[model samples]
Target: MSSKNSFYSIAHQVNKPENISKVLPYYSGLEIDIAYSASKKQWVVAHHDFNNTKHYSLEDWLTSFKQLYSKRKSKLSILWLDIKTLDDNNIKDMLSTINKHIPKNISIIYDLGRPLNIINKNFSYKNIINNLREIDGIGCWITKEDLNLVSKVKNQLITDKVKNTIISYGEVVDIDLEVLYKLCEINKNLQSPFSKVFVWNIQYIEEIDELIAWQEISGMIIGYKKQMWNDRCLDQLKYLNDLKVKFNRNTPTTF
Candidate 1:
């Protein structure tokens, strides 16, 4: 996907097993929280730092998801894994689990808090890991928290051969609209450092409208509170769903 196109996936963060089944059919993208479980001696799906008795094993979750997906005849475009905790001790196990569980066709996006030494290890899964440095929520290659440094970060990304990125879009500490547009323009070029740009921290209908209007974002991560999807929110989701279907028809698959 490039900045010249408006093809973007509307993703929802479903952190619970019960909710995953409920949400699988509505959205093409699902953002999940992954962490190591000491009790289970395996990876589990949960938003907390450590897995508890209530948490389900990652393998079980994926197995159930795959079964439900087949039964529902559903499709998932992206599986965004927010790595709550990762270290050298468990990296191998995590990767092995991923290789063994996830379907071959589904794409994975790893959202890590920092760079991992073994991050470059070869994996059988189709995946993309974001650049390390971050400020306010946007991940880029920089040591400081300055939006003005994005241009420099862009060059560094290209030099490092980085191809994917994630940005934050919130009312406070949000990226400037003009800067976001510039970043989008970068993807329009053949040598664009970032081929896929995903935005998160979005909380309002207007924010969704803005992304739709820009037509450059590759994906948007949305979170919901209980009883939060008002009529307008539902309307925006429908509009985004239509846009996703229309643009996906012409755009190539991206991770």
Candidate 2:
């Protein structure tokens, strides 16, 4: 079966490890950025801008997250380990360090900012596809035109590779009813559940209602203002759960 058929598999990306224990139960997965310091020769988890403040060193990240990371083999969620500004050797070395010290099922997805327009156009995807064989996930920025092109590329890719052997995916679509409808249409055509949607900063509980009005996606993202975690991200999870239930309702009563 295709992998694009689920709904609002909401994900969260942040540097604060304190939030991980608090938020993981409510999320599908986590998106963490790893910054490799040329001078220090270290890979650390740092998400925000300026000086790349260390939330957790690579060891700290794996040590603290061993429980969560180890389980990816049995239950995969989007564990996006974004390595910033590294040459080929450094990237591999960092992953090696992670495996040695932090030993988890990692999928080093190159978060392509432009994917089609720039970040990954010709050889970028192939580079990762060829070099980063251990990577199990992918995320690309979305535009309608790009969406069409990527869907075609994804279709061609899976045709050659072994299914379920890897977790390659993309869901870079505009967040609108029309766009979601198109995504649904694509989901219907491809017959797969979505693996990730990288949009962030969700405020207004009502917007959650809007995005999942007719969809129940699993494995995606939701950036939240401070407001989202006021009650331990409970309100947001409630909203997502409602959507999940809506989708479940359809599973047994499809026309």
Candidate 3:
């Protein structure tokens, strides 16, 4: 795998067909909220609150994504599916739809919410793993408020039979470096399930610098806005690319 880290922009800002063209060239990945529409009997893209009346079908989004990725050809674009709801039928339906549309060039990462609620009559972690094992990875969201729950969930995932790449979304206040360091340390000590850690909603570039300095973290997920392609964001992307090159050069080869 390339040592270069990736940047993922939240997809809601670019939910429209026309906006896809604008965001694709700048971002390496798109984090989309996956919600089930029982009325439509199809999955749609919407935030956790599910309040937004405008719904973008997952299939439509994937089609646009495939085209954009083909055109870009410079980097592997990622699709982070932030699953808002999961049941046996919906999980199967979601995976089936994804498998049909997912291209080889695009990577997939599932954000299966907290662990405690994952296993029940309708859904099981094993089932989710079996479905996603062929894809990129799977993870859960963690905030400072629920650190203990996150740790337990991570531990359980690590112990699972299928050893897919594990990732954690660190949702914190102001990109707290100290909190990030502690999270990494906990993962290392516990034989963490995660191979990557993504700090969400970062508003500034200095957080990226701090994460790179730590060397344990992997990437950042920036929330997309109208001005996402502005000079500041572009400069930050350039700096990350440079850092990736420097790190790759410094590392020794393992035959």
| Leading candidate by lDDT | 3
lDDT (10s digit) by residue, model 3, range 74-123? 34356777787765366777788888887765667777766565422227
Pairwise TM-score winner, candidates 2 and 3: 3
lDDT accuracy of residue 5 in candidate 2: 43
Query: lDDT tens digits, residues 41-155, model 1?
Result: 8888777746487787788878777777667644555677766665536756776776676666566666554322123332211122332211112232212243444455446
The C-alpha stretches of model 3 lying farther than 4 A from their native spots are 1-14, 48-53, 118-124, 205-207, 224-255
Predicted structure 2, TM vs. truth: 0.65
Which tens-of-lDDT digit does each residue in 1-255 have in candidate 2?
223344433444555556556555555555666676644566676654424443467767666666654543323333566545434345655656655654334344456444342233343344444444443544555545555654554454465351222122233222454554565466546644334443443543345544554443333455554322234455666766677677452211100
- Candidate that beats the other on lDDT, 1 or 2, i.e. the better one: 1
Estimate candidate 1's alpha-carbon lDDT, on a 0 to 1 scale.
0.53
The pairs that clash in candidate 3 are none
Worst 10 residues of 2 by lDDT: 162-171
Task: State the RMSD for candidate 3.
Answer: 4.6
TM-score of candidate 1 against the unseen true structure: 0.68
Reference-based lDDT, residue 3, model 3: 44
Give each model's clash number. Answer: 0, 20, 0
- Model 3: residue 92 alpha-carbon error in angstroms: 1.1
| Model number with the top TM-score | 3
Q: CA lDDT of each candidate?
A: 0.53, 0.48, 0.59
